[model samples]
Target: MKLLYTTLLVVVYIIPAINAAQCLSGQYPPKPERLLPTYVVNLDAPPVERWQDLASKYKVELKDLIAYLKTFLVEISPELQYLVDLVDTKLPAMADTLPAPYGDEMKGISQASGLPLGEVVLYNIFYEVSSLCTSIVGQDEKGNIFHGRNLDFGGLMGWDKINHTWALTEKLRPLMVQINYTKNGQVLFKTTTFLGYIGSLTGVKPGVFSVTINERNIVKGGYIGLIEWMYNINRNQSFITFAIRDMLTNSESYNQTVKYLAEVPLVAPCFYIVAGTKPGEGAIITRSRKGSDDVKLLGRDDLWFLAQTNYDNWKKQPFFDDRLTPCIKCMQEKGKNQVTFESLYNVLSSRPMFNKETVYTSIMEPATGRIEAYWQLCLDEEAPCRPW
Candidate 1:
């Protein structure tokens, strides 16, 4: 009955749309047709000049995100002036610590768009300091690997209360972009990211592996720590997205990928979910700021599938904010016959798992090097179903 309902829903909403209402139930809206733009970066091109083309293509997006994130990051600024002062003068000095191409990439973007370098630098690290997400990785009966995720970024400071506002998410729709970093015309890796942001929460390397990062909340209200972490040049901490980019750039196999993710010293805590072409090539690298607390792999001891939300697998999630249990249950119920991409999408698109803050959904099959992404629309849909 559920399968029939979903099939019908997909068929009925087959018309191409940007804000269509096609619910699997009251909550799950499957396969939104909103496609994000894909761009290729020439690795041979100078890092500071590579993104100059994109800067022109998304001039407004570049300008708007900088403006928005300035307000967003400044609201919680500890001294406020400290945050303002850093962006204004110190961004150029961050070169030694922030990896090579990233600093140059942002510089390219700033120069092309004619936007302030300070705000552009701050915008790229937005996810480094904060985000919420859910991810699942599993193997089919045929031993093929599949990965999926929902990226949830919410933090709008209202005068009375900080809240999850859809205005930002809706405004974020057009900013979605896929970056294929290539060398000599061969693609090295791909990232589903925003136009100007260099780092990624989701990415894949064909025939190699796929990775996604989820914000792991260890300590509550750690913005002060994050503020210090980003500016502390001596910490030698890896920006989470840059770490993912590094692994995709360097690692040749799944084992090496797991090892790298576990060993890297991150500037913030996160859940790094990885899947590869081989059968047992999936793991969730649960990380702390300095080291990995744990690494949970799929296809181990018959654990065919693994799901991660914002919390660690060993700890009990608070009832008021539990998406892990339901997501796992959904995966188990839908992924029974054959672990197809649609099965993973069904689990990811289910209620509670697919909430108001979910900005986008991604489904990946690493074996064939196939990946698909869709913007989850939160327009005037029914109550409890809308992202708003």
Candidate 2:
């Protein structure tokens, strides 16, 4: 009797272990009813309504729409035939690849669009569907186990995974855009120079050199400034004329390109001077224009002038002393240049000292002429000084 009781207990334990393993491996007796809530949603709706909507909304032909949607659904949930049918009827044809649950089907769309396979995947998952899922999940009930709407268990997994993936990719977009713009600008520059060479060889005056600028091709902000500078310096008036024409026609590059004007050597120097100061620094200088005004100065020691004449001598040294001395001498020669003093003071006070290794870049067309020194004051550590 004792032996038989021991045997029965061992059998009970073994049976449960086997069943647990089977459940984990999904080899257990089918429990279709226990599947997630997505299993219950009707994937099949009226085919005519679905096809018409897909055509109208997504602008995909009915047949292609049906095909892609079918593939997309199958990738997300193979067993959920009803859900697939529902998607076919309810959703528009996916013109773009979707991330995660539907990512497997992206291969086909990537090929169709002629975009890199990686980029197509990124656009679909990170840029498009990730935003869509975040919007959906935010609206979902806090306790809802079924986190995603219009998605099956597999699709939900994809959405969850894709969100994590996008967090990383989104951070890299700006950096990628910077690199791409730099590379493209270099290529375009070389191509323009080559064409100029070809024209020279044929004994033909290089016709008006034209540059097409579009947001898609150009980098935003500072890099755009850099490109404009390069174009102006290399191509001269013909390039400027072309740029002006584009500007008048309201080209996308106009706002950035047209702001630059040729004013001889003074333009480049003035831009260098202005560019050296931070944006708000100039405003601060303007506000502190009067000598009687009290101003709070932030102690930043990064100010330096580009030493144009003695490059070899000044190459290793900061141009702070040489730059400031001229302004100081000028201040003495003609009662303190108050505006120049305030501008320099505000800049020194407000901006942090940038590292010596940091690169400063700007673009300005040089034209000939000089302007009077507006204001100058000697920077004394304790007080602003001027020779009477």
Candidate 3:
């Protein structure tokens, strides 16, 4: 009886254990191994002609081209080490900023270039090459391949599809704008706007002007250039209308914002007139500092009427034909006499939104209520002034 009981207990536990082992094994699968292809080359022969011939004969996959380049780098590692040493010695004097930690510096570089930090760092180490090297590494629809110019491992694979360029190239341009507003050295607004105002200005329906406050930072000197660029691009009221509509309502990614606006009609002419205020003041003063003391607000009612009138006049006049000149000469001529807020409004209000401006303001004036009023017009699609 004792032997029988012991045998039954052992069988029960053994069965459960076997079943548990099977279940566990089924739950966790083995990890798949990473496989990359190998390329064989003959060192005895001339290499340049051989690569050219191969590229001509076959559609080399981007992956295979990268691997080939890596092998080539390994062959010339010693030479590359010497060059790196030279660079390390010379770079310190040229760089104004101290070297950031591997991680932090990479983060900063990525933020600056608008590229993925990891990819940027990798390219900086392995694929640092001359423009000649870039030209040599012919780009195909699939990938790029190259021989050494600055170093052996100079070829980069996997060009970003969305950006349609190497990750490193993307890192060359500043991706974010940092604004610093200070009050007698006390920081007020120090903030970063990604891709800065470019995305906002360009992504909107083309000619519409929109204003955003970076409460953290106030640029004391840089506002003039920004305003000028805004004026140049947004002189058309229809474009302004479209830009405003998309900016307020569109959900597309910033990259696709231009694509969305491309379809919209460029209508009402627009310009940017920026004004700044002291830390405590609610008043807006023009970058040009030409506004009257009583006109404190940036976009007051008087300015709105002026912009509307300007748009109306702009539409009525002969479409300015001087595409080559930096400033529209005819448009400026029309605006010359109409510098004051009241004069601009009086000229513009006489005509419909679509009618061209017969008169132009040669001297630039501050943008006031017109900017906000146009925005309001956009909000109310039913407004009588809304251009179809």
Name the top TM-score candidate: 1
Error in Å for residue 121 of model 2: 10
Candidate 1: 10-residue stretch with minimal lDDT: 14-23
What value does the lDDT take at residue 191 in candidate 3? 22
- Strongest candidate by lDDT: 1
RMSD of 3: 30.3
In order, what lDDT does every prediction score?
A: 0.72, 0.20, 0.23
Q: Residue-wise lDDT of candidate 2 within 1-388, one digit each (tens)?
A: 4345334533643233222211011222224432211111011322122122222332223223234333444332344243344332322233222212233333343434333334332232211111100000010112111100110001121111333211222222211100000122221111111000011000000111111111111112122222333234321222212222222223232123223322211101111011111211110010110111111111223222211111122234223212223322332332213223223222222111111110111111111111111111112232321110
| Ranking of candidates on lDDT, top first | 1, 3, 2
Which sections of candidate 2 miss by over 4 Å?
Answer: 1-178, 182-388
Ranking by TM-score: 1, 3, 2
Give lDDT tens digits, candidate 3, residues 278-347: 1111122111122121212312432211121111112342122111121222223334332333332222
Superposed by TM-score, candidate 3 places the C-alpha of residue 113 at a distance from the truth, in angstroms, of 13
Q: What is the C-alpha RMSD of each candidate to the true structure, in Å?
A: 8.1, 29.9, 30.3
Choose 1 or 3, whichever is better by lDDT: 1
lDDT preference between candidates 2 and 3, better one: 3
